[model samples]
Target: MHLNEKVIVITGGGQGLGRAMALFLAEKGATPVLIDMNSQALEETVRLCHEKGVQARAYIANIADEAAVEEVFGNIVRDLGAIHGLINNAGITRDAMFIKAKDGEVSKRMSLEQWQQVINVNLTGVFLCGREAATKMIEGGNEGVIINISSISRAGNMGQSNYSAAKAGVVALTTTWGKELARYGIRTGAIAPGFIATEMVMSMKPEALDKMAASIPAKRLGEPSEIASAVAFILENDYFTGRVIEVDGGLRL
Candidate 1:
């Protein structure tokens, strides 16, 4: 699907990978429709897109809320006339061991709240937004693409049971939606990113960051633009569906 003039919805478009994607698509002539809970950041991203000389708009909504997701997509189609793509990039991390023990005595465990919060936002949010976007795309008679942002942690990281589970579930949804939505001219894909230099990651201690960089075969963190490039490749490639592209700087968990 050519991005020119296409209306693309990006969840978490306020910053990080989402912002990178919005700007990249804008550069390619796509109209970016940003969905984020951060009003100020959303406004800033929209302004940046405008500076790129492309049409852009921002909606403050929690993708995890079913009603909000439905209403937001409805409004996008109502206002934009159509939606050609959606990027499920909004997610959160709640890192905790499933069970933490010291000297055979249980010290702590991942709280149910932690598990539920990550699942609600990372996995369920993707489902809600993807469903609404596909419905709108079908009704508008526009072929569309949905991209889910998974993570290398989906393979299971030591301190991130919740995050890992949610990200892995995202991939499962991508595969199922790819088959189910294909008849409606909708394609589904996922990206599993390794450690990227986003605000959250870069905020880590210098020693920790150095250790992380050393662990990756590339000896560095990935730039947000590299992940954006993968997103663009998925958007532009007609046959790339039901698959995940990894942009992890040669890092594997």
Candidate 2:
């Protein structure tokens, strides 16, 4: 994938790592198609991409909604002609311990709502968007790429049963899609990021942030640009498929 003048769709392109990826790819001559629920943020991202001297468009859609996703992809192809790549970067975390006990007396447990919300947005959303993107790519007869954003916590982290399960499922989907979609010139890959300095993470207290940084072997939070670079690598490398590139600063849970 040369990226030049290619149409790349990025979910959650309103901010953070998604915004970084859109800008980075825009610099490489790719026209970014941003999907997010935040219309204002999406507008800002599109403006930034345009400032980079590339055409960009934004769509407001709830990716977890099947009909909405299908319609969004249909609109993209209708408006843009074809999709060359998709980055399944939209996700949410509803963190809670599976069981919380004090002195052997159970006080709290992860709620079904919490679990379902994460699974719906993170796991199912990825599946829906990936399916639609692949369908569009095939129909247009374009070779494309799909990249799912996983996390180090996919290995199972405390107070994150829902998130961990969803992310783990994302990796499984990546592997499965890589195998099934290869015959169609569509590649699939995943990236598991460590602690990154997104706006939400950077808002933590200084001491808390310091503690997190000290735990990673790299001794610092990752930059959003670093993750964007990994996304670019997976897009440009023809042989990289069905494998996850961990950008975790040597940290494991």
Candidate 3:
């Protein structure tokens, strides 16, 4: 479908892949409704979209909170009249091994707080946003698309039990929602990205980052715009649903 004036809601639209997707969609003539917990960053994203000659609005809300999500989505429906697409792109990681051992004795273990925090934001947040978006689309009789952002680490990465499990669940939700929502004219898909050069990833030591890039077949970190392009493809393709597009530079895990 032509993106002209289409209303697309993007979670975590403040930065990284979310920001890139928002800007790209804006450039394509879509109106992006951006959500982020960081108000300043979200405003900056809105400004950037405006510069692209698109109508974009920013909302500061924690997606994991059911009430907040419900209210924000209600506001969108009230103001925008219909939602054509939604990108469940918000996520966070608290990396830690399930169990840490020292001298054959238990040293530290991944805390419940760490596990719950990641699950709440990464997994539950997606669920909340997806559910609300689907409801709005169905009510509006809008044939819409929902894109979930998974990670290559969903395959089970070391020191990322929580994040891996949550991301894997996201993939499962993408397929399940696709099957259930197809009859309603809503499609669902996922993008499992490899190491992207986001601010958080770039914050690592240069040598470590370079080693990671060397391991990938592409020999370079993927850019946020690459992932944004994948999002556009999914939205534009009507027959694509219930599957994952891995933009991982041939990274196996």
Candidate 4:
């Protein structure tokens, strides 16, 4: 879609892929309504978008909170008119082995907190934001798109049971929503990225990061802009729906 003057809502738009997508979309002339729990980070993203000549706005809201999401989307529509798209990118990772067996003595298991927190934000948050965005799109009587950010870990990455499960759920929701929302002219799609060179991934040790890069057939971590470009393709290609665009560098679990 030509994003000129279009209003797109992006969750977790403070930094990393979310921030990169926001800036790229803004450069395409879309008015990005950025949402994140980090007020300072959100504001910084907005400033960067503004500097790029887009009227971007930031809202501090927890996507997992239904009430907060509703209120924030409401304010977004009030401030920016109709919502054209939503990027469900807000997520967190609390990686842990499902069961740590040390010398056959059952050691540590993934905590309830770890599992619940990941599910709450990664899965539930996507559902909440997609639902709200679809509602507003249908109510406004406009065709729209929803781009969900899944991960290559959805294929069952080691030490990421919680994250993997949640991302798999995201993929399921993407196709389900695509089939269900097509009648309403709202297309849904997902992007599964592998080892992107974001801040979080860069924090790993050099050896570990090098190992990760070597594992990918592309011989490097994917760039945030590449993922953003995939999102744009999904939006512009009206015939695309109910499918996942894997942006992984030919990596298989």
Candidate 5:
């Protein structure tokens, strides 16, 4: 699980938490396969990694597209050799209420498409990537790690029914996959992050961000590097799997 010289796949590696994780892994001498749907952002991440003298590369593909994912992964293996680790980090949030519940209340107004999109990327994508990665790892006899980027919202956010459901599913998948993949010598784990200082959160209204910070016992925004630190911990420890490490400054939601 040492990062040095390991081949790792990081979905949504173009920006946000994914980019930070990729950079940190590369800094530790891991060759990261940066996968994302945004070609431009992917390129930018590669350039940044190169500046840091890390061996990093980018693959442009939509994780929601099965064929695209398979094709891109095939090319990565052909080009980068066997993958030793996978970080299922691609995710999207479509904030909406089940119905027009007053102030993020629960009802049944959420459109089918909204829920489906989040599920496709957050939950199903974990299964797809984990299955594919484990298949290769077993075939290559690689005993490695699989990390899924879950979120505190998995506990149930006020207006994040779809996101919460999908993230919760990811945690379930992490536990399930860990046990199932153990026979193959692969470990699966997840990270549930609290409010971090990603661009998405920074863009929120100042007062809203302040409120979130105040709610956290830490009284501050968690850094992306803190989550990266958690990922490193997960990968480095062999016996820690089929469980989630909540890295949210002690915040439950």
Candidate 6:
């Protein structure tokens, strides 16, 4: 779990929590292999890490594509050697109320497309990446860790049926995988971050944002680095596995 000399693979390592975690890990002497669909964003992160004198590189691929993810992981192993960790941070949101009836228009149906998209990346993508990483780690007969980037919304978000379902599934996988992989000395855990002021959440209405933040005991949104710090803690704590750590500013949703 030590960052030193560790090779970690991160999904959605472009411009949010994943990027922040990758940067922090690199600074700690871990070689982070960042993967994202945004080439320019990934490049920007890689550039910053390099400027900071950290070991890092990037790969651009759609995490939802199983074949592409497998290929990217393979190439990462070839380029970075054995991976000591995997971070499943790639995710997307498609929000729709389970039932909406504002002005009688009554629009609340969650679309098949929305549900499928979120599941493909947030849930299935994590499974694919973690499976590949575990296979490699087991094949090499080494110890490692797998971190799933879950969210507080996993419990259930009012308008984010798809996101909620997908993230909820992620937490389940974290616990199940941790137990299933214990024999191999590979640990698995999850971090559920709340209302972080990333580009995604900051784009919401200021008043809505305030309401969300005020709901939390911290009375402010979390920073991406804060979540990164939690990841670091989990990585270094050898006994922390099969548990979902909440980094949501005391917010319980």
TM-scores vs. true structure, each candidate: 0.98, 0.99, 0.98, 0.98, 0.95, 0.95
Of the candidates numbered 1 and 2, which has the greater lDDT value? 2
lDDT of 6 by residue, 1-253 (tens): 6788788888988888988998888889888889998999989999988877877889988887889978988888888778889999999888887776788887668779988989999998998899999998988777999999999999887889889988999999999999999999999999998889888889999899988888999999999999998889889999999999898889887
Q: At residue 181, what lDDT does model 3 achieve? A: 95
Record all residue pairs in model 6 with backbone atoms less than 3 Å apart, i.e. clashing.
Answer: none
Point out the worst 10-residue segment of candidate 4 by lDDT. 1-10
Instruction: Name the TM-score of candidate 2.
Output: 0.99
Better of 2 and 5 by TM-score: 2
Off by over 4 Å in 5: 101-108
lDDT against the true structure, per candidate, is 0.94, 0.97, 0.94, 0.94, 0.88, 0.89
Q: Which residue runs does candidate 2 get wrong by more than 4 Å? A: none
Query: The CA-based lDDT of model 1 is what?
Result: 0.94
Q: List the residue pairs that clash in candidate 4.
A: 1-236
Per-residue lDDT over 1-253 for candidate 1, one digit per residue giving the tens place of the 0 to 100 score: 9999999999999999999999999999999999999999999999999999999999999999999999999899889899999999999988888998999999999999999999999999999999999988888888999999999999989989999989999999999999999998999999999999999889999999999999999999999999999999999999999998888888878
Candidate 3's C-alpha runs over 4 A off are: none
RMSD of each: 0.8, 0.7, 0.9, 0.9, 2.3, 1.7
State the displacement of the C-alpha of residue 88, model 3, in Å, after optimal TM-score superposition: 0.4
Those runs of model 6 whose alpha carbons end farther than 4 Å from true positions after fitting are: 101-108
Tens-digit lDDT track for model 2 on 36-133?
99999999999999999999999999999999999999999999999999999999988889999999999999999999999999999999999999
**Inter-residue clash pairs, candidate 3:** none
Better of 3 and 6 by TM-score: 3
